[model samples]
Target chain A: MTNKRNQIKGFCRNVDEKKERLKKAFGYILKDKGFGNLGVNKVSLEAGISKNLIYRYFGDFKTLIEQYSEGIDYWTSQAEKRDYSEMTEKDVLKNLLGEQFNYLILNPEMRQLVLWGLHESNYNTTSLLKKRELFAERLILQKADKRFDGRIDYRGVVSVLMAAVYHLAAYSSVQKANFCGIDLSQDKGRKRVLDAINLILDNIYDLNEDKKKATNDNE
Target chain B: MTNKRNQIKGFCRNVDEKKERLKKAFGYILKDKGFGNLGVNKVSLEAGISKNLIYRYFGDFKTLIEQYSEGIDYWTSQAEKRDYSEMTEKDVLKNLLGEQFNYLILNPEMRQLVLWGLHESNYNTTSLLKKRELFAERLILQKADKRFDGRIDYRGVVSVLMAAVYHLAAYSSVQKANFCGIDLSQDKGRKRVLDAINLILDNIYDLNEDKKKATNDNE
Candidate 1:
């Protein structure tokens, strides 16, 4: 019984190693050829793992690709595990959006994946977008001050902000063009865009202040 | 000499007819199979015009596509010709954005083409995006009240708004999912989003008013 248990543990260790190798291979493939060229054969060849093992371990190519994608979650899979101690709602949004812009600009492969996601009928990509919205809800909408509730349409604001982020990333990735004369490819341009985002966020908070002031003035 | 002139006119007429046929075929193919499946063979087959005529008339499929795409310009092609007299600034923006949303929704072919344009390195598409910016500039920036300048980031505001429009249109086309609980697929959800957009626009104008009020109070 002791010998059998040890043998099973050894097998499990080998399986984990193979899974890690497969995942690393997928990253290499994704970085090299992007999401469009990713296939089981290429991954198997890159990882030096057999096709049978890939199938057996990950069930299918789609599942394996998804498993590999978790390492590069665009939204907040890794950040979800963190605590937001003492951070204002504004700070959270600024950092979150700023980080997203940097992440997309820095990681070409991720941008490609996201661009592919926008077009392809892939379940994992769709789910990832949905997950992103959920993360925004948890971080922004749910935590926003109650005083600014109706005055600030959190959902609309977030939606427009996110759309801006995604579009900027995608546009900068492909072309050297500017959105509204702000070239996102350059730092100055990017700063201007970020400032614009901050302005919008500030406007939301300011709306709350205006309401309060109006009431006080009347009183 | 008269016979020769008649012959020349006949030849010109034939060329125009073939060009029109090729252009129509390209549209049908785009609407049917999207930009991805568009090819010389597909266009030829659809147009019922020979490959020779296609090559002769357009020089190549790329040029042919570019020409076809100009007719379906996403911004300010047909709309540019319309009169915007007797409209407030807010009315102009609201109508412009609302029309954009409807145009994107109604024209799936255009959406796919726009999505393709975002990724692929096509000169025509790139030019179209530039033209789109110019359209926004003409409609929004050029028409915006100059007194509201500096105090309100009009360029940033327009950038974010255009980004929202493109991203929302692209997202709704590829997925059935809603953004921030707003189902863009449904009219009610779309209205909610449009309202959010209006609110943002209103905030920009309101900022100008507030600044003026503060100045007056200080005086």
Candidate 2:
């Protein structure tokens, strides 16, 4: 009975340690070679674990990949970490986009992943995008529609704004030269982009509110 | 005298034909294998022209690349073709941004080039970006400042809108998937983005105009 218990304890520790190792190896390959290189053999070799063991532990390599990616992807990671318990709907939306811009700028690996995701629309990337889309639908679209009450197309607003954040971060990461006279490389240039985003969002919020009030007055 | 003149004419025709062939090859490679696959040997091979002729004709490979790229790049190509002689400054600016969105959406090669341009920012892409920056400075920034004064940062507004246009077009070209609840693939979805763009641009124009009038009244 004592021997059996000790074996069980050892097995659990082994599984936990191996999972961590696999995650580190996945990240290393993802950064170095990009998403396409995350094959079973390469990852198993990098983790220095047996292929069968990895399969046995994760059930499938893709699950491990998805699990690993979710931790690093800004949407998945930040969704859990961000405290939006107190802010207004407008504030939460603004914060989400600004934080995304900051996160993509700071994380080169994440930027690379985004590039690959845009380039290739395989099962993996499509799946990743689906998660982000679902998040947007539930959080921004559904909620913003309720608050703004259809003053404007809220989805379109977020789409353009979110896309701008993604593109600027990706472009600025490499070039940092300029986009329409705005030098994204410089601190001043980046601030201008962020400020403009804030300004636009504020304008939108005001527009929604004013339109809302006008309708109320009319009634 | 007749023989010598005919020989000179024949040589000139040969050079023009070779230039066309080289341009075709460059486009072929740029679309097929991407920018990295563009090398002298491959272009020569595809064009069925001697490597020495390519060098002798263009003076250098980079010049050929730039020359070829300029014709396809939206800013360089459209600068010559677009009829903005009669439009107001506001109309022209709005049209430029909106046209870029339509152009990028329609041109897949342009989208691919954009992806590479963002990924790599060597002399080629930077120079390309420089041309765009110069155009913006000369055309938009200069005139916009004269018109709007210190009303708003026109550059920032343009940056977000332009980047969003690029991102959505590129993302839509490949994935055709929903981004933040906006599906860029469908016509209705695309119309939403374009409509939102016009609305945002109109708001900025009105804001700038309103601020300008307010300042003028005070003076």
Candidate 3:
């Protein structure tokens, strides 16, 4: 009985050590920005573990990536948790774009993942992409119909708006450049960019109303 | 005298051949996208020339890149040559965004260059970036005050719009997937996206008018 119990304890300890190393490997992946420096050798170096151990724990690099991808919904789920029902249309736009921009800038790891997600990859990141689309639908598209009363292409407009927010954050991080004289490296400059987004959203509302009114008069 | 004349002719012929080879090397640069296949060996192979000849003509890779950079302004200059004074604000927005979207889709090489220019590089692509900004200033920023009437952040707004246009073009090229149900691969789908852009621009005009009216009422 004593010998059996000792064996069980040893197995549990090995499992725990493997889990820790796996977590460290994932951290390295996020830091490296989408498999730029990804290899079993590199992960082992970063995790302070042996190459054989990583192969033993994750089976292979593909399996390790698959495990990491399971947590991809964390950001999207966080965005979906917010309740925008009580907010005005303008406020909704502000909250959505502002939250996205802030989240991107604040979380560089997530930002890299999102930017990497935009490109075509052999990896199975389709789940991550789908989660983002579903979040956009729930948060922005459903409200867009009533907000603009179908005056705009809700999906396309939201896509452009969201894509702008993403590219702005990603571009500003790597390049010390400004977009249209608005400095992106500074918070003040990024805020102006957000304010400009709100103005564009406001424009959408106004244009929709004008279209509706003109149609009514014509009738 | 005859020998001297022959020497001059041979020298001129060799210079012209080197120039032709250099032109072919630059063409490979655009096609390769982000200098992935660019090197003395690769360029020489593409141009059907020897590596020593390239070094003799352009001195080095840096000078070869610098020579190519001089032609980067061709597109921006073409945009600046257009007369926008006679155009309405809506038409101005249309022409600008339309030209940009169409040009991006039609000219894949230019599109690749623009996307590649977004990231930091060892190559001297700064002049290309500057030319794009200057073109924006001339085409959009200079007329923004009159079009938006100081009600909107003209610079910021133009930046978002331009960024969106770029991301759309760049994103659509690589990924087979569509964002938010907008099929970027199809002409009809792209047209809907463009229409969304026009609606957003139209909103700017309407919002500015509403702001002016509200101010008048307050006064």
Candidate 2's docking class is: medium
DockQ of predicted candidate 2: 0.63
Error of 2 at A116 (Å): 1.8
Best by lDDT: 2
lDDT of each: 0.76, 0.81, 0.68
Clashing residue pairs in candidate 1 are none
DockQ of each: 0.51, 0.63, 0.50
Error of 1 at B10 (Å): 6.6
Residue clash pairs of candidate 2: none
Candidate 2 structure lDDT: 0.81
The reply for model 1, stretches above 4 Å from the true place, is A1-21, A24-49, A145-147, A212-219, B1-17, B24-38, B45-48, B85-90, B143-145, B212-219
Model 3 C-alpha lDDT per residue in residues A1-219, reported as the tens digit of each score: 999999999998987777676766775676553433456777777777877876777787766766665444334545667777788756776787788787766665665465445434445455566666666666666667676666667667776787788778766665565567677888888888888888777666666787889989999
Q: Name the regions of candidate 2 deviating beyond 4 angstroms.
A: A1-26, A29-65, B1-8, B35-45, B48-54, B216-219
**Order of candidate numbers by DockQ, starting with the best:** 2, 1, 3
Best by DockQ: 2
What tens-digit string does per-residue lDDT give for candidate 1 at B13-115? 9999999998888888777666667788888988898998888888987788777777776564556776777787668777887788778877766776676
lDDT of 1 by residue, A92-162 (tens): 88888877887887776677667666665578787777777677677777777465656666677778887
- Write model 2 residue lDDT over B1-219, tens digit each, in one string: 999999999999989999989988988888776654679999999999999988899988888888887888888899646677687766777787778878987876677667767677776677878888888777667887776676798778878988888888878777856877776788788888878877787888878778878887999
Candidate 1 predicts chain B with a TM-score of 0.84
